[model samples]
Target: MAGIGPAPILFNEFFQMFMRCMPPNGWPVNSKIAVGNSGGPDSTCLLFLLQKLLTDLRSKTMARQSIPTSVVSLSVNHNLQEASHSMAARSAANAAAMGIEHLTLDIPWGTPPFSDKPVASQSMEQVAREARYHVIFDGMARTGAHSVAFGHHADDQVETSLMRLARGTTELGAGGMRRCRRWGMGTGDVEGGLGWVGHHGLDRWIIRPLLDVRKDRILATCEEHQLDYVNDPTNFQPEITLRNAIRQMLTLQEEGKDMVLSLLIITQSALSGLPQHISGSLEKIKVAAADLQETTMDLEGGLHQLHGAVKVLSSRLEDVDNEVTFHLKNLTLPSPPSTLILSSHALPAIVDPTVRLALVLRVMRYVSFHPWGSLRADGNRRRTSIQRIIDTLWQSDGAPPFTAGGGVLWQPAIFSAKKRLRVGTQCLGRRLQLGERFAWMASRLPAVPYNMLDTAILPSKLDIDVTERLASATSRGDDFLEVLFDCRFLVRFDLSQIPEELVEALRKSQETGVNVRIKPHTKYYWPKVVLRKPSCVDIAYATLMDNGQIDTFGHAPWVTMKYIRLLDAT
Candidate 1:
């Protein structure tokens, strides 16, 4: 792939690549797309190519319908170098020349991490990348763009894969950057903050349509169109960044350079396709075993029900011997709202470690509380960590409850059975057949620190007028407070729905100069709050109106809470 050097990206090929990387939910008509244009060859080319693709599509279909689709150019001024502002300005000028809307966000260099002395360090490149994406995401959301597209090309992908390999990453990591994925954690950090528009805890996407196009080809496209672009001097200095170093290494004049580069690209292409294939196979297994409830059922819920039925039968002397004769009533089991279940029987017959690792990561991402805490980048150590858990799952007696990445607690399904070989009425037994019917349950590790909550002061009236910082545009001027709890659940509290008595009490407290505070009702939280069908958790709050008077409320009808997949393991 690398040997197929620079060539102008044909419109058909660019459109195909763009469509291939489109979100599962295809781009809506009349929706806006934000391009990360940095006045560079890659980004500038991408902005133009994307505009061309959308334009072509509209001219064919959308144009007839009179629906309009739009593109906007977004630039993040990191302010890391003297030319940062000029580069941003240049990008804006290029976008203007192309008749595209452009916006530039200047980073607050005076901020903590940026302000800290010696801001330029080994990690500076990564910091800037994270900050850039953060600004881009916020810019997209505010501008009504559904997705943001980047200009990472084929060369970047190879370099990324090589870096991951050098860092001892897993097979998935070695596969390199995904063509399309949810915009997630900041490199090594989990995004969280108040008044920060980036971490809105919604399912936003990042698209890299040019991942298959080589950088040289992109530059060629720019030249073919007479589009202007600037080369950042820092990118030429290999000593300044790891990516630059890799780029320099690949471009070095050597006897086997082309062969080595070609091989690397071919290997990455293969590796990148493996994950999707394995995931599809796993889904087939889950579907085939759904009827048996052996693999498709919730682990803990099934085990609890099995145990409950056994206990009920054991109490009856007649039913104990004649298990199939009687049916138990009012016996039920419910799983935690945030819990995910995986059964050993769901796995394929083969013992490929990559498949198993993918399965574990899927569950981890589904149940993990913090996006920053995933094991994706932990490298070889991560494999070892996950393998230990997998090894335990394969044991005859089953593994004890343990914690895993993303603040997930894995509990091995336990059962007590006196006998087997019966339907619907067998005493559950401990130590089921290994890799047959054993199950593992994953749930959010409880009690995230409530430091994000504002405990400074209580409002005069405990009404639907809390801080506006947490409001989402989806609220549409509604008096509601939204928060991403544990980064696992989107918890929205409707201030407008407060009870009249609580509101009156708060008003009274305010007039009386009573020092009040709003706090989480710790007693009604996880492990204490019973979870049932429909898969949603209740969050409670206590308003301390005065020394003795306290009002407590649970998010039931007023507040809408649900889970959002913040990190896709891929």
Candidate 2:
């Protein structure tokens, strides 16, 4: 696959840099890297060079140098240009010729649902970027790839910085793109801090090996190697897009090479230094996280420790079995039900404001089961609001329960009455429900077992193991459960536990004469209602006899169902 070799020293340096990005800690031995290939010079250069690096590493006899990096080239077709699909095909073909694995995705690249403007006039580049990353993340998920390698060079960094600056972004914008970070699926935001949140922590490292490489060297290498790549004409159309405009400006600055290169280095350093920058800020937050506990009405507390102030320890939780509550130290505390309270003086011990905000963000994330980047299209906006809410809570009189983050509500421990005030962390979703079987958040993605009675047997097609995995995939409290396989169906899992006011609107079918059925929840969740004469199992059996299919929708005033199909595996 090579007609020419990249400069030995230059290639070796960048190769080592990419190798270092591999997690030093435990990772799958067969860790795969998904290299984005756009059939363009920059991407082609990175791809071929990576191919050479892996080949050399594996071919070596020395144990120390024998690195086995499973690699795959991903070509995403956004249907932007007329020949875009053909370009993607060529990318896959090139990977085939080089004996590397390849994956091609046909993404719908029209105006994104996240977009505000009309389809015809919307920014194709922005929409394409989002679509491309979504495909990349999904491909990584399916292939078990650990990190995504991009061909973005120093020039790309310059362009991103300039574009964000022109649009008036924050300090993060000044740092340009992160050298290594985590990108979660369906979550548009990228996270640079500690910890991983996805089921397998797949939302990880966005490596830019070419961050230090110049655009000119990349083009030269690709040409010298006779690599198949196309120069995107869109890059020269500066007036059409901000990034293109930055690129055009860079071409006119022959004397400004050092300055541009320096700026890139500065941006890279700024991003990489952030972890160390905030390292000291989380100490107090960590302490608070470890201090959580549950509580109640006409509160009482007996404590012996530093300061003697009460702690609604973050370490305590009501449902110990729930994954979200796995870290709690006590099930019950001196606070209200569905709430954890700490001495109001708890945060004052740590004076650093950054640490306080970080701690609050951590608590919110832990409670919400949402990682740093889980916010949807409005990620930045939501984060800003979250920060604002934290600030407001910090300043409030510490009495009434106030809504903080869009999804969370906070209540400060009552002062004077308690001998002193205690800070409270209450799940607002829970309080509104008053008395329920599960938390309000859980109702959003509900999943109850198929068995409603002792005799009810799940259809054989839903393998016991797969079914368990599928059931776990659905949120226990979430209202909608979509099973995306052979026994295809969408359901509104029963919410007898949730308050009547927070109920989800049920789904109604538009197609007439299509046999529709209403299924029931697990017998344990709604024992009384399901115990009545006709159970969900009975209805399903009746449907099976009539239409030869056991599938049915949830039969409830609040239950909405779609695409119900129950296949009999046996």
Candidate 3:
């Protein structure tokens, strides 16, 4: 909004769209924003607009006042095409000409997707898209940016929606891409796959300001500004990709132009609003299902939203609502939710199957070790496994402990007759009788083996340091590091708390370049210091003693864990 006034008619509309698509709270005053610049028409236009916006913002602020808000263009060179490097250089040069800071992320040629030749494949676009996502996020991490903007326009949305519908998709998928979503492009099915270290505890946001704008308008902006841009040859080759084919079909049509425009309008008018409705329903269910009013705690030193206790309350069933009511024995709520309990009653009362599936998935995303963003694979097989779990939960017959996707362990919550009797008497307001059956208790599946298959699948260790993988991006001067462990817990380690002996050894190893590691402690007391190249990323050993053993909570108290909000589904 700072740059909207005194702008050309074209740019005013662009700025309005950008503001509308921003996060609810908008960006903080001193925050930095990163833009993905491909040197193409859309991205080029965005870069120019952002440059003008920054200039206006600087001029508006007092000369003595410091304006820390900045924008940087991140150009990623996939190296799959011959002109990739040149295009990246061109983009950098253009950004520098506009007085904008720029960074180039070059993907290695012999990476997994390019490990084989870059031949025509059905999935090559997806592979390239994922690679670009990784490169952009890596750039963001280095730049200390929590938000990244893209140049996906309305045309891209239409192509995407049509593609998904062609294959098969749910209502949400049919709605196409979101204007803003959780930054989760590179996260895969494996928990902590990318091994991202969070300097800021806030979740990453992806912004597409151009989603509502037409592609023609973007091209016109580029032309009006006399901007130079490149075109990816593969995009014009219809034989190479489905998107290209669809694009060619749409572009070559001279007769049905009105129909095409009408279709886009229909999509914008009708389908674009579906995600908001679904999100609202999910939020309603989540709020009604759990009571965290008294237990939500905000801690100091960047720690936030810690939950002390949570009570599952009863709610009236709606047309598309889950009727499950959970009553913990003796009126005592569950402590901090290591295991979550849900009742099986009235599941059939929920008329809509889509809502039912969505509710279960939402619960799984929360309770599982993998957060919502980490579950990238949404194939039929995964959904079928979840459906099977739902079916099992729906049945009254008691089943043994079962494991589902995202490492969520499900089993029946058992109670003695006395406990049930106490619940019946104490929770009479809920209108529940004694000796009633309670269904599923969901918990984080343990890393150790309950079976041989578990040994093969579960992570061998959770505390391993991935500092080397992210060494180039992390700050070297920080005495502590905040890690989003297992995508659920924000674990902060105070490296300054290590013993003097260990610190001396680490200092020595830093200069000598010797690999010196302390012996694994048998007790949960010692704070170990690891010295990686460039900086000290942290991995504090919290579980040195085995489970069920008595250990001092005061010992090695430098490490603290807090729960992070993971409901952002992008």
Candidate 4:
């Protein structure tokens, strides 16, 4: 056998490299794959390579005989320039040339563009990126795609690390991007219908196959294959973008030293000992010390409250004095109380109450109620309501609740417990009594699930009005009525035997009781309400109102009240 030269070998070096990195579990064989093609060198190279790889694998794999494979190419036209459409067209044409399915997505330029750079003056790169992904995900859903692939290279990773360093972000940011990680639905937006509505979490995936490869290699591959690519003129605008500056920096670094190798070493070093540190921290802390539910933290004296399960809660720095606070739900002390404060700058320590009180308050707001267990067991239905209420408070610029040793209390309207119970009973009876009205109301509500009345607690007249107002505003569906009758005194009644007219009359009387109970208390600023849901055991947030008894603010669409208590704080 004569030796063959590398030139005539027909080897796809990039494809081989990509395949080697696949997990032992292998690439999702049966998944409908999507590739993000920007008509640029890197993405174009990826599109062709993936298509060829899929075709070759299908032909070779005997085990995948029953598995069907479908591939689609997605091109995002950011509309940053007139050439965007042309670029998209070229991308589509290339995919067609490869005999693969293609789709072109056009994202209109955002107004004032959510970028640090001026819209007309420079590149709206960030805005364009956000818009581009939005379009890609939308396309992914429409086509029944299981995963979307991108062509981020090694050079991009180094640039990302440098940018995060400049901005004083956490070490996690320095990790660059993950090879594979779950995408965020963008904070609370994930809870809305817009959050992963059609997307499968575990089955559908996103892969970055070219992360380890260099830009030069990708460009070289495109050149060797004689693939035509479109160039964006904005990329040449050196004065406007950080990316251009970063590209220049990398070029300078390449000239000075082995930039890629150096970056690899630095990133590897920074990340090397992270796992050990995490494991050690976990071992030192008490298993039950940390709270995962409330997203708040608590500290007393020298005692440190650490969550075994970490929660990464973010708030505006200005809102909380440029510090990150965690709500330590169900946090218990691991050790003796020492005076120590965990600040934005210093390492956490144990100290006296005088020193720790301020620190604890900054990080965690201790509440009388711990709702995580209830919320988790019940599917977070009440938590949703609590979030809605918080949103209302923030929008209204109302103050958060104040806390002391007993529990945190909101200076809000205090409704009578008797009234709340009466209202709840009435709401529950409505379904038992007037099925027609319950059905009619439920249909009018937007997100209210079926069989809601079977599980929900009925609010008093005022509370019912609040629920109605919220539904009307957000178009959510009606709530069900479930009463947590006093366990101490169980009243026996056959719900099936109750007459509709009699039930209605009883409900009216209950409504009067509710009114009488609430009417006497007018000193508080908002109503102390408890929301109970099957998903949430017990959670509380305040509802704010103005002097005119108008619905001024503090309503949550996501949380349900479990119970409301009045405070004698005079």
RMSD of 1: 15.4
TM-score of 2: 0.52
Worst 10 residues of 3 by lDDT: 307-316
| Candidates 1 and 2, the one with greater TM-score | 1
* TM per candidate: 0.69, 0.52, 0.65, 0.45
- Distance from true position, residue 497, model 4, in Å? 23
Please give the lDDT score at residue 454 for candidate 3. 13
Model 1 score (lDDT): 0.54
Best candidate according to TM-score: 1
Top-down TM-score ranking: 1, 3, 2, 4
Residue 133's C-alpha lDDT in candidate 4? 64
Model 4 accuracy (lDDT, Cα): 0.41
Supply every candidate's count of residue pairs whose N, Cα or C atoms clash at under 3 angstroms: 5, 33, 0, 53
- Give me the runs in candidate 2 sitting further than 4 Å from their true place: 1-9, 24-26, 60-68, 108-120, 141-144, 166-168, 188-205, 223-226, 253-366, 369-372, 376-379, 382-387, 390-400, 413-570
Candidate 3 residues 1-570, lDDT tens each? Answer: 464322232656766766665664566666777889988888888878866765666667452133226888999987787888888988898888888889999876465433443455665666777667766777888998768888887677656644554454443443456667666423453433333323232457888887666677788777778988988776876555666654654454323444344334323542243233322332232232232232321111011111111111001112123222122222222422234566555454554555556556656665665434545323232657877876776765556677767677765654334454221123222433466545456656656543442124334234435333223222364567565555555556566563444345445554655332211222111113233333453233343232323222445554555555343233
Tens digit of per-residue lDDT, candidate 1, span 1-570: 556656899998987788777776666667788899889999999999888877777768534233228899999888777888889998999999988988898777557434432364566666676567667777887888877889988667656654554555554554566677666543333234312332342456778988766667898899999999888878866555556654554454222445345334323542233233222332332232232211122212222332232223223322221221111111111234555544444433426555455555555665664453234322224756788766765555455577644556667643223322211113135445532345566665544433522233322211123322322322455576655444444555566764444444444543543222222323112211111112333233443221223334553344455555532343
Ten contiguous residues with the weakest lDDT in model 2: 437-446
Question: How would you encode candidate 4's per-residue C-alpha lDDT over 1-570 as one tens digit per residue?
Answer: 986422311346655555544432465657677889888887888888877776876776673543227689999876666888888999998899989899898664433222332264333554555566667777888887867888877667655644443443333333455454433232112212222221133234567777666666777778778988877676654344555444543453455545444333323442233233222322222122232232332211111111111112212112222222221212121110111111111223322221232223322221222111111211232334333333322232223333222222322211222322111123332322221111100001111233453244433322222222332322333343221111000112223432343334334533442111111012221233333333444233332232222231244232222222101000
Question: By lDDT, who's the top model here?
Answer: 1
Off by over 4 Å in 3: 1-9, 57-68, 111-117, 188-202, 254-339, 343-350, 376-381, 390-404, 414-439, 446-458, 463-478, 481-487, 499-552
